[model samples]
Target: MNVLRVAVSAALLLSNAFAAAVPSIKYCQNPRAVNTDYVGRDKNVLVQYTACDGVATTQIARAIEARQSNNVCGAPYNTSCFTPSGGGPDPNDCHVITDALLYDSQNIGALFTLDPAQNTSLITMTYQSCESFMVNQDNVALTYCRTDWASILDNLAFNCQATQNAHGGLSVATDQEWFIQVQHS
Candidate 1:
């Protein structure tokens, strides 16, 4: 009972703090567009804004929070480990992913999960085991940054096929995962 009370109090305090920190926001027909413009502007400027059609105030706050959490360069989907909160581009979290902006990035606005990371680790372990076997036999570990199998081995390692192939300096069976090229490697 005491723990529950403490939890409730903590929740209220955090909620209030979040409410205080967030900028003034409104829901409108084009909240997504408005938000895009707002976030893209110079940081010195302070302005309250809306998002695209169906985007809600909550989502706007959530997006801002996600960006703030990243606290680094680039927006969600454009960078790694940064998952955009709220679904896709709309203010409405309920909006179907396909209906999102053509620029919709962030793993197709899929929520971040550990599966891809785990897959990469698994594939890397397998590759390493193979490497050890080959190296013990006096074979040079032949590899290319082949990202073609990034998503297969670990979605987080590389996004698209192009990213995989062009992932300069990435390991094949070494420190990094070379999942697709496992057979060839």
Candidate 2:
């Protein structure tokens, strides 16, 4: 009886620990689409719609590729061009469709918007809650770290949050401050 009780307690503890380790989803803005028109002249371009967390990067990449190639055209028909790639989409090629194709930047601030419905599978990097640890119970530190589980959670959370709010009728707004810098400078 004693051994069985210990085993049950250990199992319960392990279960809780595993649950805690599972990361939660967090919304992340799409990275700015850098205009790859010229090297060292990367500029942020405005987009009509923003990508959603539920969308896959590969899908977005495929869509952009099709659009660029002009293999697909029209509204509803053209929309199919943005389908996620079944094989694998190159992250480098996936970008926002503006006046022209642009490169993707890591900086979240640089992200442009894309039509979530049209490009239902294009999302930027996933986000996780920043973690911190105390040193000697006197100092605290926080850092945003990436984990596979965390990335999945962030994507789920972002999708849920976006869906709950206005049924996913969200729009991407360019940071006016950042735009000013790019425009003036």
Candidate 3:
């Protein structure tokens, strides 16, 4: 009887420990479709919509890739074109700030709007929280799509805090004025 009691106690302790060790799953919001006019205008373009909050960078990269191609007629590449199709303030001002086709492996790319006539301003795209990071360069706002959470945290941690508000959207805030200096190629 003593041995059996000890065995049962050990089993219960092990079970409790194992239960406590389990990690809870974290949830992120889905991506949604915004700027449908851009999708409608282009026949070759595809849009995968979801809630902007908690979207992974890999998904954004896929959406960007869906709009990219080499045979398409464009200025950046006559022989090849690797550009994403998303509408913004300036229809002709958006381009991949990272290596054109290499964004797939890199899992992130910075996009900017170049108007050269206005001071940098935050361009609002009501589609994704990722776009909220956009800041106008000359006159065009700089934008980014990222895949890695760690990298995102590293860059935005210093000044930005992303929190889920009552409206079920991610809101980012900074302690003071926010400014980001990005180099373009």
Candidate 4:
């Protein structure tokens, strides 16, 4: 019994350490436009914000929390959703993403920045992931069977849109310079 207890305790410690190593990513929406119908389909206008700097991440979290509201909207397909909180054109909205393959940039060593014009590939990936999350919010098994595939595509269509529409009315020029990209040697 004592040996079993020790093994269980060791497992718990290892699990905690693994959890600690995982980064925390915050998903925040454009507060002004929690959900928008852009190009004839409704999409949750959200962004994935995170940082390598602990202080900056904490500050961003606080800023978002300060503006967060409990008001849930039955949106897209009558599902409950929360309002997005963030500063309008706020500096805190920008966070660093490490090990990113940025497009059209001379930088190397895996530094990625959100460039509205040049980072089309990364943007496409983000949109795809967001749509996946929206469609599988309940963690349901997705099927590609002929009859179900159409409905799945419809959900993806209704929930996904261009990222340009998600940025609280910020122009492309502004978004171009919004994030600070750094490549580490």
Cα RMSD (angstroms) for every candidate in the order listed: 22.2, 21.6, 23.0, 21.4
lDDT (CA) per prediction: 0.20, 0.20, 0.22, 0.20
TM-score of 1: 0.13
Candidate 2 has an lDDT of 0.20
* Angstrom error at residue 133, model 2: 19
lDDT (Cα, tens digit) per residue for candidate 2, span 1-185: 32223222322322221122211112212422222122111443222112223423356555464233221111110000111222211212221111122123233322232232333112222101211110000011111112211222222223323223311111111211000000000
Error of 4 at 100 (Å): 20
Clashing pairs in 4: none
TM-score of each: 0.13, 0.14, 0.19, 0.15
* Candidate 4: residue 13 Cα off by (Å): 22
Best prediction by TM-score? 3
Tell me the RMSD of model 4 versus the true structure: 21.4
Poorest 10 consecutive residues of model 3 by lDDT? Answer: 72-81
Query: Which candidate has the highest lDDT of all?
Result: 3
The candidate 2 region of ten consecutive residues with least summed lDDT is: 176-185
Q: In each prediction, how many residue pairs overlap at the backbone (N, C-alpha, C within less than 3 A)?
A: 12, 14, 12, 0
After TM-score superposition, what is the CA distance of residue 170 in candidate 4 from its true location, in Å? 21
Superposed model 3: Cα runs more than 4 Å off: 1-108, 111-119, 127-165, 179-185
Point out the worst 10-residue segment of candidate 1 by lDDT.
129-138
Candidate 4 regions off by >4 Å? 1-76, 79-81, 84-132, 135-140, 144-185
